[model samples]
Target: MPIDIETFDESSSDELNTLTNAEMVVRFLATNDDKAYTPSEIAERIDIKKNSIGTVLSRLEDRNLVRHKGDYWAIGERETVRDAYRTHRIMEALDERYGEEDLEEWREHAAEGE
Candidate 1:
């Protein structure tokens, strides 16, 4: 038996290369928001490692960015997701125009709370 090989055009390859695992998972779930899937299903469809999916899903759940019930996962509220995307785009634009923020500098200036 022989295995099948997959191929991508230039644009698709570039797009895939630029997206992080979290982004890919979010995009996949968003596109199929009408349906829920197990982590294995999402990993297979997104071509990500099964082990990594759990961590990603857990983090997203903690942030209320995604929902999980039983063994299935689905995207969170549409408005929340949209707001997150909008904020991410704004950050990207700011980074491009003024350079990425220095984490240490930000931490130094951050207000302390009781």
Candidate 2:
């Protein structure tokens, strides 16, 4: 979500003035952590028009920084998401060749050496 223009305490809109519409949207969403937002909710909080919110969200989604879950939008590129994808890819490629028990033993031995 964009900064709550009414509640944000900045004396001037200087900081927001320099940002492109997409950047402003990103900054707002970043500050909200994992919170999901809708186009209308985003418009209410920032300088963006309600109509433009969907466009900005589409751009962010294309860049892989935002994603939609049903009707709600949330941050993408989170560590958990990235790690899960990476881990799945790795396991799919290697699981046929390595037994889970062997991998566990190897991990324990590696940890003991440290």
Candidate 3:
């Protein structure tokens, strides 16, 4: 299911003030998942600078929380993003101990001839 709007109330400026710029951006996009928005548009709504929004957007995209469609950006598939983040954390931990090549081999072994 898509995220519940009440999960982060976009209508409450008081609640919005508690979040960092990145969190605010995520909440904005998540609430507005019905449509895509340009960075400038997001910045205007979220009270962030248009020029500085790129880094925030890039960070969210890197973590799979947001995605772009042509020039506009939107929230990503929630389940897929969650799964990707979990896998990313697992890989980081595995790579820290066993290294990438060893982790890759381990993954292949775990696949059981798939």
Pick the lDDT winner: 1
Question: Which is the leading candidate under TM-score?
Answer: 1
lDDT tens per residue, model 2, 15-94:
44566677566656666756988878877776578888899899878877778887788767676445644674477458
lDDT of 1 by residue, 1-114 (tens): 111232233225444568788877888788788999999999999888998999999998887789999999999999999899889878977987999999987777774431
Superpose all Cα atoms of candidate 1 onto the true structure and report the RMSD in Å to 1 decimal.
5.6
Ranking by TM-score: 1, 3, 2
Q: Which stretches of candidate 1 lie above 4 Å from their native place?
A: 1-16, 108-114
lDDT of 2 at 90: 77
User: All candidates' TM-scores?
Assistant: 0.80, 0.53, 0.57
What are the per-residue Cα lDDT tens digits for candidate 3 across 21-111? 8867877787788999999999998778889899999998888799997779998888866576468558767976887676678888989
- Return the TM-score for candidate 1, rounded to 2 decimals: 0.80
Give the total clashing residue pairs for model 3.
Answer: 0
TM-score of 2: 0.53
Clash pairs detected, candidate 2: none
Model 3 poorest ten-residue lDDT run: 8-17
* lDDT-superior candidate, 2 or 3: 3
Go through the candidates in order and give the clash count of each. Answer: 0, 0, 0
